[model samples]
Target chain A: MGIPVTIENPKPEAEAGLNDLVALVADGMARVNTTILSRTGSEVAMIPEVANHLIASGGKRLRPILTLACAQLCGYADAEGRDGDVKLAASVEFMHTATLLHDDVVDESDMRRGRVAARIKWGNEASVLVGDFLLGQAFRMMVEVGSLRALDILSAAATVIAEGEVMQLTNAKNLETDEAAYLAVIRGKTAELFAAACEVGPVLAGRGEAEQAAARAYGMGLGIAFQLIDDVLDYGGTSAELGKNVGDDFREGKITLPIVLAHRRGTAEERAFWQRTLQRGEIEDGDLETALAILRRHGALEETMARAEGYGAEARAALDAFPDGPVKAALLGAVEFCVARAH
Target chain B: MGIPVTIENPKPEAEAGLNDLVALVADGMARVNTTILSRTGSEVAMIPEVANHLIASGGKRLRPILTLACAQLCGYADAEGRDGDVKLAASVEFMHTATLLHDDVVDESDMRRGRVAARIKWGNEASVLVGDFLLGQAFRMMVEVGSLRALDILSAAATVIAEGEVMQLTNAKNLETDEAAYLAVIRGKTAELFAAACEVGPVLAGRGEAEQAAARAYGMGLGIAFQLIDDVLDYGGTSAELGKNVGDDFREGKITLPIVLAHRRGTAEERAFWQRTLQRGEIEDGDLETALAILRRHGALEETMARAEGYGAEARAALDAFPDGPVKAALLGAVEFCVARAH
Candidate 1:
């Protein structure tokens, strides 16, 4: 008679891994925060205005934290190669922020970080142009750091991210997007930055190629897990936690993992329902509830969470290259924290 | 009764300077063209579809040509530092093309390069993302050249260009925007890249700081002249030549040099006419003609061309460091060609 309420869904817990990583990298983070605020400042008022609207918004700054933590894990202390780490960390954050501004416009979402979106605040033209400004500043910082290897990694990541965005656009609202296709989208959009952020840390620390590879693998797995959980949470999380309205991905017809699983498991009639709501954009009032019912009936949410947990494990295994230490422990905990959000 | 056609505005002539530059750099230009096409070919179908829609549409490729000519003018022959020149030249062209894609989206243009605009053909989201791809590739090529100074200059130009775009946004449709403000906008939006494009060539050629400074000055002056001529042509040139709809600036409320002069010199009635049409968007069928008449009455077009020619002279003066040869003559002639577009 109503939408199925799955018992597999658990209450959202405090993100301990994120908190630990934040505290562990507090000093490096302070430097990064300063770099971000300073770089966003421009003689052109609109550049800073639109940039800070989102940058100043209180996201976890997790991507930069990953950069700092990964660098520390690789034994890059403040005296040795810490300056490069901090600079690269800030660069990663700027790149992330720039993508968010552009992504909001592309997705036509009106909210970001629980506030009115930059596109809504300054208009799409301002958002797009300011995003370019941030990206330009990101590259400037990368050049200042003067690490060709780091530059190569981050610049390639930028290209991959853009390509991923185009790939996502091509797959949007398509009922036929499969798990392989879904993984490809997240790998580009989310995981590549995560991988680049972690990989660059070891490269700057003068660590061996093996350490860099481990860092890249760890970050990529963590990024995939994090995004999978995000896709999961879009259906059920609170706006306070999400910083945007729930059901956003659904509203936008993003072909995320749960939808892919649900579509595969549902009946022919259920498939038609999804086709009408997602592909054709005939989202009725109770369509979200019905979609949830079908997803739960087929255990799609639990399966999606299980897949995220698998990725989180892979991420932890990648960190095993480092000897046991606070930094390593914190990174593993961070992986757990990413998957825990789905609970 | 009709729009005043100024006697100073002669019929469009053959672009001798451009033709000469192209011929002088023909070998390097061939390599650059190859790099551009190779880098732009993406696995994702939409990216190339949107990118090549603009890139292959017969742009003058003036920026890349400048990079080649500047390097050759500094005595960087193919046997010496020619490979880097070709890559960087391609990089400059890619950067220019990226900006064009974003510019069309920002301006909501429906035409570019005498064809339907990329935004119209693929939508804003596709255009913006593809532009990012080109920029990412541009940096990749810059990094491969292994010149930190070149990367620094180009990256800084990218940031300044974005700021200029925002400045232009602030000045749009505002009759109060003066000559100084207009110059600042163009300096950021246009001249910065021009300056960087020329400066990087000398920098890569192992040239001294003095030579680099000279190249920067040459590029800055040429870029200013080029942009001023573009502004003039926007009001009077054919769509075939301008590669955009004429009177676009007027319709969009852009305060270019011609409008700045006319606004400074116009009477109360004429000022009100500008305010009503440009500031308030109350354009009538014959308003473009009326606007042209006002421009002619103040000799704004002719005076704008004079300012462009002045900058062209400055550009030629900056080339004094280079020895007399085919490259030097071609660069000087290129300046003449840019200004000659007005005639």
Candidate 2:
């Protein structure tokens, strides 16, 4: 086996959890998808072309779904004038897609969601401008919702995500990058948006601070779990399973959790190998396979999943304040779904 | 003369108008500058590095000054709890700077404000991410002000700006792009922000809709005039005067007003020259000089300035309802200053 298969019987956790989550938020998701399509429509043909290219590419619409589910869990209803959650959820997706477009450009990525990257398809200039258009559209939707609190959450998250990107850039190819630094980067890049997406749901519902905090914590935990699983899958999962090429993070010299773990646990010779391959970006033909072997030898993938499980547990715990309703159950299942990518 | 020197003795219009306007809103401008500096500060080293590289690169701060001056013209005072204009003005600068950074990247520019472009200094990735950071900060500041109307104005402007950018992309190097299409491009790319900047001031001061509309009109007119002058300067002005390389627009094959005018009036051979150099992008040595000779032959520069003057007069007319005062005079003078660039 290219990767050590620790789970003798891997459960279909992602399939089941995602299906249940989608069912729980089906109506809201439908409205959100419609809102996304309508808002992304522009007189400028290039705007729609670039935006739709990314939006239409199949990826789980998890962040927006979380927004809707959290709103439902908070008991928000249209009667209470909280129907703006639908738009806000769509805004969350736009923000996510915008970041992805910019991220692909930053990463100089070749593929996304099993297809050529937008940057590769249209060029870097188009990717950057289209990303800006999406962000502008996102802010417009947030303004339409007329919630200063929600706007605050989402805008601040946008800043955090940008900062996270910069942080990731600084840490890339630096084998000396530590776990705390890794956590901070992921928090800014991945968890912050998730936190904002879920937190705004409560803000839209006019829920109390505790409820908002709980929702935010749930999202942050799930997001961290999701990213951790992503890091592991980069080394071990198939493109069919992950919807992206395996070893991409390696090629990009991204210092994810497994890399950090493997580096910390490695011998002096192994450290030199990482330094040359990752830090110097001088990868040879078999470096990726060797990296995978090193990761398995150090139990890095296993430990990374264990860490993801911990975050998943934390994510579930954050939903304790809400009653054990369908929304909460779906949300808890999302945490399971995200972490189960490692399986 | 390449363009008609309508002003026999050219006044320092931009310099004088900017000085008077700054004096009128000196306190607000200072505060706005402070807010800009503070908001752009981040723990991420690359963000500040890339952002400051551009923010300090000697932009005239014209957009923020307009924001402050317009707020003052609307009688917004800190005593009346309209101090948020200072923040909003800074936010406007942030938005403008953010766009400039992205624009340089999109345009593949090597120089900005007589210095190397941020993209050259850092990278396209840094410039794009830092630009996003500034925009996120802009939205956060808007949210802090808690004015949905102001947010609405600015957010809509942002979308329009993005659309304008895409429109420009589609129109780039196309010889057939007409004056109407050119006007539409400038309206989206340049004037929308100016209109939004001025309109938000009135919104903050709780002015009537007519007053807001007037302010927007003034800004729109001045902005179009400003951009018209910029297009003229690209061909005739020195690098020292414009803070960018002359012929940049021509080199990039940007179909500006002058180009449209020249194309419409050109002989068949001249039209063929434009098609080969612009539409087909086979730019030969000394093609810029030939293009200049053609613009002069058609009086495109003079006619472009005439159009700008008309808009300047319209801008002054938009302020007709307001009482004569230092602010109003400075505002009117700004129109002269903007259009005077053609002289």
Candidate 3:
């Protein structure tokens, strides 16, 4: 009592809806994390250093969690007490991490996940090669799981993701990019992996085509919603909350939904501002604030959030194929969490 | 007067030894080329543009030819007239092409196959992403072949290649890198894929582990010889013969065998030159000539060629397990061709 006892500040509550999904898959994710760490090891020291910088960073393991939850929903059971889902979950993470490495290099990004990007910390050469290493390791892990169908799904997803990235590159700073084109790009780059991650789970669980389709649809819907929110947060949220600099899309002149919507709806003068700052790469100091103000006035961020909610609702409905359970509830909660990130 | 059509310059006789192997695999190679063209097509036009720029360029296509030759040596015959070897051959080429793309970026190489590198013509971002697309497509084609064992072999080779690339990166411009380290780097980057390419052929042909081992050993030995010759040609051969500028390795300060040998065998003064030019990146005009003189003074290039001959002999001896036939003869000749390139 003599010592002025002070209690540590109460720990901030975990992100509301995502925490539920995270808690539900905590056991599976532990196994996945173990697999990820073990598989990323190489005699080449730089590989694990670069890969773990991103892998061990605190981004939500949302995609792998989807893989685990989908497998559980499909009633996956293995006699040897070794589920292929764990390896597959790790594989999913590797693919994601590999893409992130390449993306940072492509975008010349300085920060990622509230930390300096691997490409910036390491060199671009290291980032590119390490990304390739992780991708190779990902395929190796998939082969070990011995599921041809799963491999097909994931490999095809990878191809689509690459195609999407190139498409996005072509679309960057092009104000003429319409919603349909934007959707195609995001579906290729982002949604395809989510779809594959969810689809592989049911395939490994020995579930039939119907369940697989349901899982894929759910993942696809949720992934689109997730990306839409990401675009919104790039303009509407803070770096501390987003784990990336706010208005990074604007800085990079990346034409996302907000930019697409705003440009289409903007007056000639406002469009000129976008063209100068984004298209022409003549960004001035106050441009991000101007971009944000333009986005708010036009309600572009709100409309994007609305579209995300629509996709989230669809993701929720896709899970109706399975009986209501903790896994299913958690999956639905994850979708809500993705959409709610805008707020 | 019969229009004296000037007879086209008599086609230079194909390199004596490699021509035999190429002729043996010509029919299969046609199918493989078709598969490659069809597989690389994407709705994203830049992918095919960048990919075909390399694939359609006049490189020897030696690796895919090895896959086809090994399958024939294993007496692969598919009843439906659809040999998985064709697809596997294409997959092997895609992997090689993907590696070439990434390597060009990592090396900042300007010329490849006597043409501008795709990375320079397009951009590093496109090169990285398109290389990824090709890798993904390679795996997709492997999965279509429905051989999990083949997938395992190739995927493992890919991981090793990436690790080797990283190892090479670490070794670059570092004078302390020794011959053992150099060999390790090449084995990981070069021989592993060759080993896998040859190993998968017998696996697809339903051969036993012994035959697979023989094929793998042959490919491994041949691969080492091939890379040694490549390293030699970089210094000793002409730009037309080598299809890349001579002294590129020296300019890049790459720590290959010649540099390693010369540095190790040189006098204190010579070592200082190497340390200043390579280790410290203080290369000056005429540095390449000085490097060449040092290498020649130590007989480094000749010793490297001798080493290639030794490996080529081992590669040839590996064919003892197969009956004496055209395929065996062609394979042996191919090894000789690899070594003879040094001349």
Listed models, DockQ each: 0.84, 0.80, 0.77
lDDT tens readout by residue for model 2, B1-343:
2333222323565568667887888887888877888888999988878888888877778888888888888888667564698889988999999999999888999999889999898888888899999999999999999899999899889889988988898899898899999999999999999999999888888899999999999999999999999998888777766678778898888999999999999999999999998888888887888888898889999999999999889899999978899999999878878888668
- Put down candidate 1 lDDT per residue, B1-343, tens digits, no spaces: 2233443342334376678888998988888988888999888899888888888898788899989888887877556543789889988988888888889878888888889998887889998899999999999999998889999999999999999999999898899999999999999999999999999888877899999999999999999999999999888876655677678888988999999999899999999999999899999999999898899889999899999999999999998888898888888888888888777
lDDT (0 to 1) per candidate = 0.88, 0.87, 0.87
lDDT by residue (tens digit), candidate 3, A1-343: 0111111111233256778888877899999999999998998999999999998887888889999889988888766766589989999989999999999989999999989999888888999999999999999999989999999999999999999999998898899999999999999999999999999989999999999999999999999999998888776566665578676888899999988898999999999999999899998877787787788779898899899999989889999999998888888878877777666
TM-score, one value per model: 0.97, 0.96, 0.96
Number of clashing pairs per prediction, in order = 1, 0, 0
Cα deviation of B172, candidate 1, in Å? 0.8
Which regions of candidate 3 fall more than 4 Å away from where they truly are? A1-14, B1-14
Q: How accurately is candidate 2 docked according to DockQ?
A: 0.80
The share of true interface contacts that also appear in candidate 2 amounts to: 0.77
Give Cα distance to truth, residue B162, candidate 1, Å. 0.2
Error of 2 at B226 (Å): 0.4
In model 1, which runs have C-alpha deviations exceeding 4 angstroms? A1-14, A78-82, B1-14, B77-82
Docking class of 1: high
Q: In CAPRI terms, where does candidate 3 land? A: medium
